[model samples]
Target: MGARVTIVFAALAAIHTLTPTAQAADAFATPAVTINRADWRAAMDQLRSELNAAPEVAADFALTARRRSVAADDPRQRPALVQLNGVTSAIFTGIGRSPVPVLLPFDTTAYLAARRKGAIDPQALPRHQADFQTDLFDAGPSGYDAVFSLPTEATSGLPSRVFARPVEIQITGSVLTYDVADPAGGKGESVKALAAQYPDLRRFIREGYVRYAFTRFGVPYVVSIQCLDSAPRPRRLACREASPIAERFLKALRIAGGQPRRLPPEIAPAAIERPPAPDPDFTYRPAGDIVVNSGARGQSGRADLTAYSQIRYPLDAPAYVHSQSFGRRRASDKFDQPWSQYPWRDNFCEARSFNVGQCASGFGHQGQDIRPGACPVRRDGPEACDPWRQRVLAVRDGVVIRSTRQQAVTVQVNTGTEHIRFRYMHMNPSALDADGLLNGRSLREGQPIGVVSNYLDHPNGTTRHLHFDVQLFTRDGWIWVNPYMTLIAAYERLIGGRGHEIGTEMVSSSVAAPAITGTLPPAAGPQADAVHAPN
Candidate 1:
């Protein structure tokens, strides 16, 4: 028992001796991942506080960190809350170009409401999400108006505004103006299909651009890159090289969800105007009915049928719809006779140096031709029409997208319901430049653009008339669709009366067209502004 007691004491002594060492080891040793959770939590709280203070700063928190409780936020922070809670975020140009792709989270309810105004069928929209604003640099890249990136909203009560924007990207050796639209409306293929087709993207879109369309989170997205092969070799970038760049952009897209919110009034459904149906009194020839004879354009005849829009009569005064051909007439005379008399003709499919996908032949004049109102008093000069008197007018409320040193000025109407561009041609380029009718100019409906003149490539290259045409946002970029229907619709509205369509045989034969006449709206008063487009 004494020996046992001695052993126990010795054991206890050994334990007592090791206690200090073990305590020292415990002090040295620590968890493999002993997270500074306190510090981490503090940082998160700091970020949330900053975001709440200035919702726009949420863009600063992109990958850093990021929400869904607007009701819980302070009332003043409501807009900022949404703006901050993924409800409001801005993509700021980083110190340099950001390596990250942008995620433009949309309010699903607001998106649907905008489409409803555009006459989009509610059932046709994707169930989880309606139509998505395309990621086209043209779309998300391109702003509908020159004003700002997203639709402008100035609601009286809101302290802040919600907006979506893409992260800016840099592409060397390629020239892209950053316009937007791909799968603009309707739907597109799945992301998998787009990936499969990415290798040969040119086959998918018109204009030979590398275009990939895919859907994510039930939203359709399109990304297009032009070969710019036409660009210098050192600067040239093709689809093969551009596909990866575009793919990266696609990868960057993420959905930022916010609770249901109302859209701005301008694009809201209540403000939308439905396009009119074909009026029985409004008569026009079937679209694509090219006089079928380009050589005999001097004696051209064929009234054209048209499409919709809230548009002003293109002409400031009542005008004659006739052939104002660029081609020389059979005789010394410009196209062998009176250029203004008409049963209305269609030149949208007339022969041209370029290709027009809308034409049956895939190559023709891109637009319709309309002459000045007075044909009887033909004047001799660079233009046959009275440039000082007769004029062309803005067809819709829009911005001037194209005003070149060449011969055309294109005004673009880019609202939720309309993505159409109106081109005015034949007026002298010098004159347009003089009037400050250049890109990014603002215009209202019925605003005087320029006078109808005969300036084609040069002065008097074509007959004195407005070579008016239009283009719509399509998968093929800005494909020139036949504006015959749109023009007819605008004219009928302008005249405040109905027009009956006439037959080609009636104009081709000895019978003269029953002069369809209507006076211009009193509001279409003369303005010094004149505009110009392609021949």
Candidate 2:
């Protein structure tokens, strides 16, 4: 009765092992394109609206840089010194309040001296000039502000003992004209004092007018002033209070300032927003084995075959048959062929004569030489073996971590720490479709992708064969496994061969499987119970 029960249990286990779950669906799908024109248009519209509402206004006023001469003979024509270059203007555009433009004059010589040492090229005069202009106007919506370096020289009178020292003259003015009697006309004195010091009053007014235009039109302004002294030879001159004409002109001018107000909110609206791009699809799984042949009669000492010596066989047995047999091919007739027809015959001949295993020396051949019928070979080129080529499918579903199509190899990583890599080489370039895989799609067992080419240089000239190699990574480094063992295991399962023992061994060896903490399941019979009971 125990024997019968044991047999029954064994049969049940076999039945359960025969059925397996279906593979998961492919993760990748064709991507689509999307565009949003309305969002872009809305942003542009907002910018235009802001510009149209409460447009910019500019005001002009004259300022003077003057020096006094110690010449009693020509006091009326006192020596005058003025800024010839380097002036900047600023304008501030408030979101709700009135726009205000501020003009700050600079010492042009000092500005140029500092700028030449750091920001601008001292040697390139034109570039320096252009940069000065840019710095003056590009002060953003903030009002114009700057310092000017006024150039000075001595006028005739005591043999010109000294030079005029540079000074900054601040000028305030309005773009619109107004009478001193107006409520806002108090600002005129400040503007007049700003211009009273310079002898070149006309040039000052011209620059002031230009500045007003730029401010009014939302442009920037800069100017240079040049001055000449008209006193007797050999006299020292001070740049202040040099010219009465300039002082009179400034005194006659008037400026006004009105209270500012805010612009309406309806003129400017918020800009539209944009969405992000889609994320990439990802997948992960363990690699499956490829089976070649099954149920071939086991020769004596088969169990003694080491991993390195697994694929050794007689030369006359056609390369393709040997590969298929080792890989456990189900259909023996599919790959049976003569040795002479094999593409690697010449290389094999050389290996045989040299006793180098590259041919038939047998032990530790390094890499498997899959034949034409089992795995397509390209004698002419990569395209020649397209029809008979093996798919060289990905070991596991994963993102293409690294690809070297130029070298005909692709490495994929399933997990960050797994460190397990699969390399598929000698594949035809065309095999990788637009999506970068076989036919731009997923591959199955025994599917055709592209033929192996002779691009990889071998010991001989080059051999036309698939050089499929597997390398396992350990903490120390990589270790090569006799892939034929795994291949044969998969093949035997598919073709009616007894695989229960192998399956049990694999389950026991798998690193991913959970530990069996309890006793083994009940055996089929009484004899089986004795064999498993605490032993």
Model 1 C-alpha lDDT per residue in residues 346-368, reported as the tens digit of each score:
56766553345544444556677
Among the numbered candidates, top TM-score falls to 1
Model 2, 1-535: lDDT tens digits are 0001111122111111111112123211111111101121222232233223322210011122222432445322321110111122111121111122222322233333444346544344323222111111211111222222222331212232233332112222221111111121111112334443322222222101111111122212222221122231122222222232223223322111111222122111111111122212111111111121111121111111111111112111123312211221232333334431222211111111011111112212223445444333444554343334333444343323212122233232212112222344444433343345521133333333344454332111233445444333321112222333333322232232322212222422212222222333221111110111100
TM-score of 2: 0.24
Q: Which residue runs of candidate 1 sit more than 4 Å off their true CA positions?
A: 1-286, 293-306, 326-339, 375-389, 403-406, 509-534
Q: What C-alpha lDDT does candidate 2 achieve relative to the native structure?
A: 0.24
The Cα RMSD of model 2 versus the native structure comes to 35.6
Clashes of 1: 32
In candidate 1, what residue range of length 10 has the lowest lDDT sum?
Answer: 29-38
Worst lDDT 10-window in candidate 2 = 526-535
